[model samples]
Target: MLEEIESSAHSSGVISMDNATRYLRPTGIDPIMGKVLNWLPKLGISIAGSRLLAVRGRKSGQWRTTMVNVLTAADGTRYLVAPRGHTQWVRNLRAAGEGELRLGRRTEHFTATELADADRVPLLRLYLEKWGWEVGRFFDGITKDATDAELAAVAPGFPVFRLA
Candidate 1:
Protein backbone atom coordinates (compact mmCIF):
# COMPACT_ATOMS: atom_id res chain seq x y z
CA MET A 1 0.00 0.00 0.00
CA LEU A 2 2.77 2.41 0.93
CA GLU A 3 4.72 1.38 -2.11
CA GLU A 4 1.78 2.15 -4.34
CA ILE A 5 1.50 5.62 -2.82
CA GLU A 6 5.20 6.25 -3.29
CA SER A 7 5.08 5.03 -6.86
CA SER A 8 2.19 7.32 -7.57
CA ALA A 9 3.92 10.20 -5.88
CA HIS A 10 7.09 9.68 -7.88
CA SER A 11 5.18 9.64 -11.10
CA SER A 12 2.87 12.50 -10.18
CA GLY A 13 5.13 14.80 -8.16
CA VAL A 14 3.29 14.36 -4.91
CA ILE A 15 4.22 13.50 -1.34
CA SER A 16 5.74 10.02 -1.00
CA MET A 17 5.45 7.54 1.79
CA ASP A 18 7.79 4.63 1.36
CA ASN A 19 8.98 2.30 4.09
CA ALA A 20 7.47 4.42 6.87
CA THR A 21 9.37 7.45 5.62
CA ARG A 22 7.01 10.06 4.27
CA TYR A 23 9.30 12.30 2.27
CA LEU A 24 9.04 13.85 -1.12
CA ARG A 25 12.51 13.88 -2.62
CA PRO A 26 13.71 17.43 -3.05
CA THR A 27 13.99 18.92 -6.47
CA GLY A 28 17.25 20.30 -7.84
CA ILE A 29 16.25 23.85 -7.03
CA ASP A 30 15.28 23.01 -3.44
CA PRO A 31 18.84 22.99 -2.13
CA ILE A 32 19.61 26.29 -3.81
CA MET A 33 16.50 27.89 -2.37
CA GLY A 34 17.29 26.36 1.04
CA LYS A 35 20.66 28.08 1.08
CA VAL A 36 19.01 31.39 0.32
CA LEU A 37 16.37 30.91 2.99
CA ASN A 38 18.99 29.97 5.58
CA TRP A 39 20.99 33.07 4.79
CA LEU A 40 18.12 35.57 4.70
CA PRO A 41 16.94 34.98 8.27
CA LYS A 42 20.41 35.72 9.58
CA LEU A 43 20.19 39.13 7.93
CA GLY A 44 16.96 39.77 9.85
CA ILE A 45 14.81 39.27 6.81
CA SER A 46 11.89 36.87 7.01
CA ILE A 47 9.66 35.73 4.19
CA ALA A 48 6.27 34.93 5.66
CA GLY A 49 7.34 33.99 9.15
CA SER A 50 10.41 32.08 8.06
CA ARG A 51 12.67 30.87 10.84
CA LEU A 52 15.88 28.89 11.02
CA LEU A 53 15.03 25.70 12.87
CA ALA A 54 17.97 24.11 14.61
CA VAL A 55 17.54 20.71 16.14
CA ARG A 56 19.91 17.98 17.26
CA GLY A 57 20.38 15.14 14.83
CA ARG A 58 18.85 11.94 16.11
CA LYS A 59 21.96 9.84 15.59
CA SER A 60 24.85 12.23 15.00
CA GLY A 61 24.06 14.53 17.97
CA GLN A 62 25.19 17.51 15.91
CA TRP A 63 22.84 20.39 15.28
CA ARG A 64 21.02 20.27 11.95
CA THR A 65 19.30 23.38 10.73
CA THR A 66 16.68 24.09 8.10
CA MET A 67 14.31 26.85 7.09
CA VAL A 68 10.75 26.40 8.35
CA ASN A 69 7.59 28.47 8.37
CA VAL A 70 6.15 29.15 11.80
CA LEU A 71 2.36 29.37 11.80
CA THR A 72 0.64 30.98 14.72
CA ALA A 73 -3.02 30.16 15.24
CA ALA A 74 -5.72 32.58 16.28
CA ASP A 75 -5.74 31.11 19.74
CA GLY A 76 -1.97 31.70 19.98
CA THR A 77 -0.80 28.15 19.28
CA ARG A 78 2.32 27.90 17.16
CA TYR A 79 2.91 25.05 14.73
CA LEU A 80 5.55 23.66 12.45
CA VAL A 81 4.35 21.76 9.43
CA ALA A 82 6.59 19.59 7.31
CA PRO A 83 5.22 20.32 3.86
CA ARG A 84 7.71 17.97 2.26
CA GLY A 85 6.75 15.24 4.65
CA HIS A 86 8.86 13.36 7.19
CA THR A 87 12.22 14.79 6.33
CA GLN A 88 15.32 14.76 8.57
CA TRP A 89 14.16 17.68 10.70
CA VAL A 90 10.87 15.99 11.46
CA ARG A 91 12.62 12.81 12.51
CA ASN A 92 15.11 14.73 14.61
CA LEU A 93 12.37 16.74 16.32
CA ARG A 94 10.57 13.52 17.05
CA ALA A 95 13.59 12.05 18.73
CA ALA A 96 14.77 15.13 20.61
CA GLY A 97 11.30 16.58 21.38
CA GLU A 98 12.72 20.12 21.49
CA GLY A 99 14.56 22.65 19.37
CA GLU A 100 15.17 26.32 18.68
CA LEU A 101 13.72 28.80 16.22
CA ARG A 102 16.05 31.58 15.26
CA LEU A 103 15.94 34.81 13.35
CA GLY A 104 19.06 36.95 13.42
CA ARG A 105 20.21 36.88 17.06
CA ARG A 106 16.82 36.16 18.56
CA THR A 107 16.26 32.51 19.47
CA GLU A 108 13.13 30.81 20.78
CA HIS A 109 13.57 27.50 22.53
CA PHE A 110 10.61 25.21 22.02
CA THR A 111 9.40 21.78 22.97
CA ALA A 112 7.38 20.04 20.27
CA THR A 113 4.49 17.64 20.36
CA GLU A 114 3.78 15.74 17.18
CA LEU A 115 0.10 16.00 16.27
CA ALA A 116 -1.91 12.99 15.23
CA ASP A 117 -3.33 12.88 11.73
CA ALA A 118 -6.83 13.45 13.04
CA ASP A 119 -5.67 16.55 14.87
CA ARG A 120 -3.79 18.13 11.97
CA VAL A 121 -6.57 19.27 9.67
CA PRO A 122 -7.04 22.82 10.98
CA LEU A 123 -3.38 23.52 11.41
CA LEU A 124 -2.66 22.10 7.97
CA ARG A 125 -5.37 24.27 6.48
CA LEU A 126 -3.92 27.40 8.05
CA TYR A 127 -0.43 26.44 6.99
CA LEU A 128 -1.48 25.92 3.41
CA GLU A 129 -3.37 29.17 3.32
CA LYS A 130 -0.24 30.96 4.50
CA TRP A 131 2.42 29.01 2.61
CA GLY A 132 0.73 27.25 -0.28
CA TRP A 133 2.14 29.62 -2.85
CA GLU A 134 5.61 28.50 -1.82
CA VAL A 135 4.93 24.84 -1.04
CA GLY A 136 1.77 23.85 -2.88
CA ARG A 137 3.57 21.52 -5.22
CA PHE A 138 4.54 19.10 -2.50
CA PHE A 139 0.96 18.60 -1.40
CA ASP A 140 -0.37 16.67 -4.36
CA GLY A 141 -2.63 19.53 -5.43
CA ILE A 142 -4.37 19.82 -2.10
CA THR A 143 -4.92 23.41 -1.02
CA LYS A 144 -6.20 25.38 1.93
CA ASP A 145 -9.63 25.34 0.36
CA ALA A 146 -9.61 21.59 0.07
CA THR A 147 -12.29 19.61 1.83
CA ASP A 148 -11.67 18.43 5.37
CA ALA A 149 -11.80 14.83 4.19
CA GLU A 150 -9.27 15.60 1.50
CA LEU A 151 -6.88 17.20 3.94
CA ALA A 152 -7.40 14.40 6.43
CA ALA A 153 -6.58 11.83 3.80
CA VAL A 154 -3.17 13.32 3.24
CA ALA A 155 -2.51 14.44 6.80
CA PRO A 156 -0.56 11.31 7.66
CA GLY A 157 1.98 12.09 4.97
CA PHE A 158 2.56 15.62 6.26
CA PRO A 159 3.69 15.86 9.87
CA VAL A 160 2.53 18.79 12.03
CA PHE A 161 4.14 19.69 15.34
CA ARG A 162 2.79 21.95 18.02
CA LEU A 163 5.50 24.06 19.59
CA ALA A 164 5.34 25.10 23.22
Candidate 2:
Protein backbone atom coordinates (compact mmCIF):
# COMPACT_ATOMS: atom_id res chain seq x y z
CA MET A 1 0.00 0.00 0.00
CA LEU A 2 1.43 3.37 -1.02
CA GLU A 3 0.64 5.99 1.55
CA GLU A 4 0.62 9.60 0.41
CA ILE A 5 4.26 10.57 0.74
CA GLU A 6 5.26 14.18 0.30
CA SER A 7 8.03 15.23 -2.06
CA SER A 8 9.82 18.55 -2.06
CA ALA A 9 9.47 19.01 -5.79
CA HIS A 10 6.00 20.54 -5.65
CA SER A 11 4.61 23.39 -3.56
CA SER A 12 1.96 21.03 -2.22
CA GLY A 13 4.60 18.42 -1.38
CA VAL A 14 2.32 15.87 -3.06
CA ILE A 15 3.15 14.65 -6.56
CA SER A 16 0.53 16.34 -8.68
CA MET A 17 1.58 17.18 -12.20
CA ASP A 18 0.10 20.30 -13.69
CA ASN A 19 -2.55 19.69 -16.31
CA ALA A 20 -5.53 21.78 -17.34
CA THR A 21 -8.02 18.92 -17.84
CA ARG A 22 -6.84 15.75 -16.23
CA TYR A 23 -9.56 13.23 -15.38
CA LEU A 24 -9.02 11.43 -12.13
CA ARG A 25 -11.82 8.93 -11.69
CA PRO A 26 -12.59 7.73 -8.22
CA THR A 27 -10.13 5.08 -7.12
CA GLY A 28 -12.42 2.17 -6.36
CA ILE A 29 -11.88 -1.26 -7.89
CA ASP A 30 -8.96 0.13 -9.79
CA PRO A 31 -6.50 -0.07 -6.92
CA ILE A 32 -7.44 -3.62 -6.13
CA MET A 33 -7.23 -4.64 -9.77
CA GLY A 34 -3.97 -2.76 -10.16
CA LYS A 35 -2.46 -4.61 -7.24
CA VAL A 36 -3.47 -7.93 -8.70
CA LEU A 37 -2.23 -7.05 -12.17
CA ASN A 38 1.05 -5.77 -10.80
CA TRP A 39 1.61 -9.01 -8.93
CA LEU A 40 0.82 -11.21 -11.94
CA PRO A 41 3.89 -10.16 -13.91
CA LYS A 42 6.18 -11.69 -11.28
CA LEU A 43 4.38 -15.00 -11.72
CA GLY A 44 4.73 -15.04 -15.49
CA ILE A 45 1.15 -14.05 -16.14
CA SER A 46 0.02 -10.75 -17.59
CA ILE A 47 -3.29 -9.35 -16.51
CA ALA A 48 -5.04 -9.74 -19.87
CA GLY A 49 -1.56 -10.18 -21.34
CA SER A 50 -0.46 -6.60 -20.76
CA ARG A 51 2.86 -5.32 -19.46
CA LEU A 52 3.56 -3.55 -16.20
CA LEU A 53 5.07 -0.16 -16.95
CA ALA A 54 7.45 1.45 -14.49
CA VAL A 55 8.90 4.93 -14.62
CA ARG A 56 10.99 7.06 -12.30
CA GLY A 57 9.02 9.66 -10.43
CA ARG A 58 9.86 13.24 -11.42
CA LYS A 59 9.60 14.42 -7.86
CA SER A 60 10.54 11.56 -5.56
CA GLY A 61 12.80 9.78 -8.06
CA GLN A 62 11.14 6.58 -6.89
CA TRP A 63 9.58 4.16 -9.33
CA ARG A 64 5.85 4.53 -10.02
CA THR A 65 4.28 1.64 -11.85
CA THR A 66 0.95 0.52 -13.30
CA MET A 67 -0.56 -2.10 -15.55
CA VAL A 68 -0.41 -0.97 -19.16
CA ASN A 69 -1.83 -2.55 -22.26
CA VAL A 70 0.88 -2.54 -24.93
CA LEU A 71 -0.28 -2.26 -28.51
CA THR A 72 1.61 -3.63 -31.47
CA ALA A 73 0.85 -2.35 -34.91
CA ALA A 74 1.01 -4.20 -38.22
CA ASP A 75 4.40 -2.62 -38.95
CA GLY A 76 5.80 -4.10 -35.74
CA THR A 77 5.97 -0.81 -33.89
CA ARG A 78 4.64 -0.71 -30.31
CA TYR A 79 2.85 1.97 -28.32
CA LEU A 80 1.61 2.78 -24.82
CA VAL A 81 -1.55 4.79 -24.38
CA ALA A 82 -2.81 6.48 -21.26
CA PRO A 83 -6.56 5.96 -21.25
CA ARG A 84 -6.89 7.50 -17.83
CA GLY A 85 -6.06 10.93 -19.19
CA HIS A 86 -2.55 12.05 -18.27
CA THR A 87 -2.30 9.98 -15.14
CA GLN A 88 0.72 9.90 -12.85
CA TRP A 89 2.59 7.31 -14.90
CA VAL A 90 2.18 9.41 -18.03
CA ARG A 91 3.61 12.47 -16.29
CA ASN A 92 6.48 10.48 -14.78
CA LEU A 93 7.39 8.84 -18.06
CA ARG A 94 7.41 12.23 -19.73
CA ALA A 95 9.68 13.58 -17.03
CA ALA A 96 12.07 10.62 -16.97
CA GLY A 97 12.10 10.10 -20.74
CA GLU A 98 12.51 6.34 -20.17
CA GLY A 99 10.99 3.39 -18.43
CA GLU A 100 10.65 -0.38 -18.31
CA LEU A 101 7.97 -2.78 -19.50
CA ARG A 102 7.94 -5.86 -17.35
CA LEU A 103 6.27 -9.24 -17.30
CA GLY A 104 7.41 -12.16 -15.24
CA ARG A 105 11.21 -12.00 -14.99
CA ARG A 106 11.59 -10.10 -18.23
CA THR A 107 12.23 -6.39 -18.08
CA GLU A 108 12.83 -4.34 -21.19
CA HIS A 109 14.13 -0.87 -20.48
CA PHE A 110 13.63 1.75 -23.15
CA THR A 111 13.34 5.46 -23.68
CA ALA A 112 9.84 6.85 -24.10
CA THR A 113 9.05 9.58 -26.59
CA GLU A 114 5.58 11.08 -26.40
CA LEU A 115 3.88 11.20 -29.77
CA ALA A 116 2.29 14.37 -31.07
CA ASP A 117 -1.49 14.63 -31.38
CA ALA A 118 -1.33 14.86 -35.14
CA ASP A 119 0.21 11.38 -35.33
CA ARG A 120 -2.01 9.60 -32.83
CA VAL A 121 -5.08 8.81 -34.92
CA PRO A 122 -4.22 5.28 -36.02
CA LEU A 123 -2.68 4.32 -32.73
CA LEU A 124 -5.68 5.56 -30.81
CA ARG A 125 -7.97 3.62 -33.07
CA LEU A 126 -6.06 0.44 -32.52
CA TYR A 127 -6.05 1.09 -28.78
CA LEU A 128 -9.80 1.53 -28.62
CA GLU A 129 -10.38 -1.47 -30.82
CA LYS A 130 -8.36 -3.57 -28.43
CA TRP A 131 -9.38 -2.22 -25.04
CA GLY A 132 -12.60 -0.32 -25.52
CA TRP A 133 -14.59 -2.41 -23.11
CA GLU A 134 -12.16 -1.53 -20.38
CA VAL A 135 -11.36 2.11 -21.08
CA GLY A 136 -13.88 3.53 -23.51
CA ARG A 137 -15.72 5.64 -20.99
CA PHE A 138 -12.60 7.70 -20.47
CA PHE A 139 -12.65 8.55 -24.16
CA ASP A 140 -15.99 10.36 -24.13
CA GLY A 141 -17.78 7.94 -26.51
CA ILE A 142 -15.16 7.97 -29.23
CA THR A 143 -14.64 4.53 -30.68
CA LYS A 144 -12.89 2.76 -33.52
CA ASP A 145 -15.60 4.13 -35.77
CA ALA A 146 -14.59 7.70 -35.00
CA THR A 147 -13.05 9.56 -37.92
CA ASP A 148 -9.59 11.07 -37.73
CA ALA A 149 -11.03 14.48 -37.11
CA GLU A 150 -13.00 13.28 -34.10
CA LEU A 151 -9.98 11.46 -32.78
CA ALA A 152 -7.80 14.48 -33.33
CA ALA A 153 -10.27 16.52 -31.36
CA VAL A 154 -9.75 14.29 -28.33
CA ALA A 155 -6.13 13.42 -29.06
CA PRO A 156 -4.56 15.98 -26.81
CA GLY A 157 -6.20 14.39 -23.80
CA PHE A 158 -4.65 10.99 -24.26
CA PRO A 159 -0.89 10.76 -24.13
CA VAL A 160 0.65 8.14 -26.40
CA PHE A 161 4.25 7.05 -25.95
CA ARG A 162 6.53 5.30 -28.37
CA LEU A 163 9.20 3.14 -26.81
CA ALA A 164 12.58 2.60 -28.34
Candidate 3:
Protein backbone atom coordinates (compact mmCIF):
# COMPACT_ATOMS: atom_id res chain seq x y z
CA MET A 1 0.00 0.00 0.00
CA LEU A 2 2.82 2.35 0.88
CA GLU A 3 4.57 1.39 -2.31
CA GLU A 4 1.52 2.41 -4.30
CA ILE A 5 1.42 5.74 -2.49
CA GLU A 6 5.13 6.32 -3.11
CA SER A 7 4.81 5.39 -6.77
CA SER A 8 1.82 7.69 -7.18
CA ALA A 9 3.58 10.52 -5.38
CA HIS A 10 6.68 10.21 -7.54
CA SER A 11 4.66 10.11 -10.71
CA SER A 12 2.59 13.08 -9.64
CA GLY A 13 5.60 15.06 -8.40
CA VAL A 14 4.09 15.29 -4.93
CA ILE A 15 5.86 14.38 -1.69
CA SER A 16 6.57 10.66 -1.51
CA MET A 17 4.85 8.45 1.07
CA ASP A 18 8.16 7.15 2.36
CA ASN A 19 9.38 10.66 2.91
CA ALA A 20 6.18 11.51 4.74
CA THR A 21 5.92 8.37 6.86
CA ARG A 22 9.53 7.31 7.39
CA TYR A 23 10.72 10.21 9.51
CA LEU A 24 7.94 10.58 12.05
CA ARG A 25 9.52 9.72 15.40
CA PRO A 26 6.96 10.70 17.99
CA THR A 27 8.32 10.93 21.52
CA GLY A 28 5.93 10.51 24.38
CA ILE A 29 4.24 13.77 25.27
CA ASP A 30 4.73 14.66 28.91
CA PRO A 31 1.29 15.80 30.01
CA ILE A 32 2.62 18.09 32.71
CA MET A 33 5.15 19.69 30.41
CA GLY A 34 2.52 20.07 27.71
CA LYS A 35 0.25 21.95 30.10
CA VAL A 36 3.07 24.22 31.20
CA LEU A 37 4.12 25.00 27.65
CA ASN A 38 0.59 25.77 26.62
CA TRP A 39 -0.16 27.82 29.71
CA LEU A 40 2.94 30.00 29.65
CA PRO A 41 2.28 31.39 26.19
CA LYS A 42 -1.21 32.43 27.20
CA LEU A 43 0.28 34.42 30.09
CA GLY A 44 2.49 36.41 27.71
CA ILE A 45 5.67 34.43 28.37
CA SER A 46 7.40 32.61 25.55
CA ILE A 47 9.75 29.79 26.32
CA ALA A 48 12.92 30.34 24.33
CA GLY A 49 10.92 31.79 21.43
CA SER A 50 8.06 29.33 21.44
CA ARG A 51 4.67 30.34 20.05
CA LEU A 52 1.23 28.81 19.98
CA LEU A 53 0.73 27.83 16.37
CA ALA A 54 -2.86 27.53 15.24
CA VAL A 55 -3.47 25.95 11.87
CA ARG A 56 -6.79 24.91 10.46
CA GLY A 57 -7.35 21.20 10.13
CA ARG A 58 -7.51 19.92 6.57
CA LYS A 59 -10.23 17.38 7.14
CA SER A 60 -12.20 18.84 10.02
CA GLY A 61 -11.76 22.56 9.24
CA GLN A 62 -11.33 23.14 12.94
CA TRP A 63 -8.38 25.05 14.35
CA ARG A 64 -5.67 22.94 15.93
CA THR A 65 -3.03 24.44 18.15
CA THR A 66 0.43 23.38 19.26
CA MET A 67 3.52 24.91 20.77
CA VAL A 68 6.34 25.50 18.30
CA ASN A 69 9.64 27.26 18.14
CA VAL A 70 9.80 29.90 15.45
CA LEU A 71 13.26 30.46 13.96
CA THR A 72 14.29 33.83 12.58
CA ALA A 73 17.17 33.99 10.16
CA ALA A 74 19.83 36.70 10.25
CA ASP A 75 18.26 38.31 7.21
CA GLY A 76 14.93 38.55 9.09
CA THR A 77 13.02 35.72 7.47
CA ARG A 78 11.00 33.58 9.87
CA TYR A 79 10.63 29.81 9.53
CA LEU A 80 8.84 26.89 11.13
CA VAL A 81 10.50 23.49 11.02
CA ALA A 82 8.90 20.20 11.93
CA PRO A 83 11.52 18.38 13.96
CA ARG A 84 9.15 15.47 14.42
CA GLY A 85 8.89 15.19 10.66
CA HIS A 86 5.77 15.50 8.52
CA THR A 87 3.57 16.03 11.53
CA GLN A 88 -0.14 16.82 11.57
CA TRP A 89 0.58 20.53 11.65
CA VAL A 90 2.84 20.14 8.64
CA ARG A 91 0.06 18.42 6.73
CA ASN A 92 -2.49 21.00 7.78
CA LEU A 93 -0.25 23.91 6.86
CA ARG A 94 0.53 22.26 3.55
CA ALA A 95 -3.14 22.11 2.75
CA ALA A 96 -4.19 25.50 4.12
CA GLY A 97 -1.04 27.42 3.15
CA GLU A 98 -1.54 29.87 5.98
CA GLY A 99 -1.80 29.98 9.77
CA GLU A 100 -1.43 32.13 12.84
CA LEU A 101 1.33 32.33 15.42
CA ARG A 102 0.19 33.51 18.78
CA LEU A 103 2.38 35.07 21.42
CA GLY A 104 0.35 36.38 24.27
CA ARG A 105 -2.61 38.25 22.79
CA ARG A 106 -0.77 38.91 19.56
CA THR A 107 -1.83 36.72 16.67
CA GLU A 108 0.22 37.14 13.52
CA HIS A 109 -1.30 35.52 10.48
CA PHE A 110 0.97 34.55 7.62
CA THR A 111 1.12 32.48 4.46
CA ALA A 112 3.76 29.78 4.26
CA THR A 113 5.76 28.31 1.47
CA GLU A 114 7.22 24.87 1.97
CA LEU A 115 10.89 24.88 1.16
CA ALA A 116 12.36 22.28 -1.13
CA ASP A 117 14.62 19.72 0.50
CA ALA A 118 17.65 21.28 -1.15
CA ASP A 119 16.87 24.62 0.52
CA ARG A 120 16.39 23.16 3.97
CA VAL A 121 20.01 22.51 5.00
CA PRO A 122 20.90 25.94 6.35
CA LEU A 123 17.53 26.45 7.97
CA LEU A 124 17.74 23.05 9.62
CA ARG A 125 21.18 23.85 11.00
CA LEU A 126 20.04 27.22 12.28
CA TYR A 127 16.89 25.76 13.78
CA LEU A 128 18.84 23.06 15.57
CA GLU A 129 21.33 25.60 16.82
CA LYS A 130 18.54 27.65 18.34
CA TRP A 131 16.01 25.11 19.64
CA GLY A 132 18.09 21.97 19.77
CA TRP A 133 17.88 21.62 23.52
CA GLU A 134 14.13 21.18 23.14
CA VAL A 135 13.74 19.54 19.73
CA GLY A 136 17.07 17.80 19.15
CA ARG A 137 15.73 14.43 20.16
CA PHE A 138 13.40 14.44 17.18
CA PHE A 139 16.20 14.88 14.65
CA ASP A 140 17.54 11.37 14.82
CA GLY A 141 20.91 12.40 16.26
CA ILE A 142 21.48 15.18 13.74
CA THR A 143 22.69 18.38 15.33
CA LYS A 144 23.59 21.94 14.44
CA ASP A 145 27.20 20.80 14.21
CA ALA A 146 26.32 18.33 11.47
CA THR A 147 27.97 18.94 8.13
CA ASP A 148 25.91 20.36 5.27
CA ALA A 149 25.93 16.98 3.59
CA GLU A 150 24.70 15.33 6.77
CA LEU A 151 21.91 17.86 7.19
CA ALA A 152 21.01 17.61 3.51
CA ALA A 153 20.79 13.85 3.74
CA VAL A 154 18.10 14.09 6.40
CA ALA A 155 16.31 17.14 5.00
CA PRO A 156 13.52 15.31 3.28
CA GLY A 157 12.40 13.77 6.53
CA PHE A 158 11.94 17.25 8.00
CA PRO A 159 9.49 19.78 6.61
CA VAL A 160 10.41 23.46 6.69
CA PHE A 161 8.12 26.36 5.87
CA ARG A 162 9.12 29.92 5.12
CA LEU A 163 6.59 32.37 6.54
CA ALA A 164 5.66 35.56 4.80
TM-score of each: 0.89, 0.83, 0.84
Task: Give candidate 3 regions above 4 Å deviation.
Answer: 1-18, 23-26, 29-32
Kindly report which residue pairs in candidate 3 clash with one another: none
Model number with the top lDDT? 1
Highest TM-score model number? 1
Predicted structure 3: lDDT: 0.85
Worst 10 residues of 3 by lDDT: 22-31
RMSD of each: 2.8, 7.2, 6.2
Candidate 2 per-residue C-alpha lDDT over 1-164 given as tens digits, one digit per residue, 9 for 90 to 100: 12333243233322333333444543657777778768877677875558888899999999887888998888988889888777789889989999999888899998989999888899999999999988897776899999999998888888899888
lDDT of 3 at 75: 98
Residues 29-92, candidate 3: write the lDDT tens digits: 6545766788777777898888999999999999998888999999999999988678789999
Candidate structures ordered by lDDT, highest first:
1, 3, 2
Model 3 TM-score?
Answer: 0.84
Model 1 lDDT per residue over 1-164, tens place: 97886677686544545424578766667778888779988877888999999999999999999989999999999999998888889999999999999999999999999998999999889999999999998887899999999998888888999999
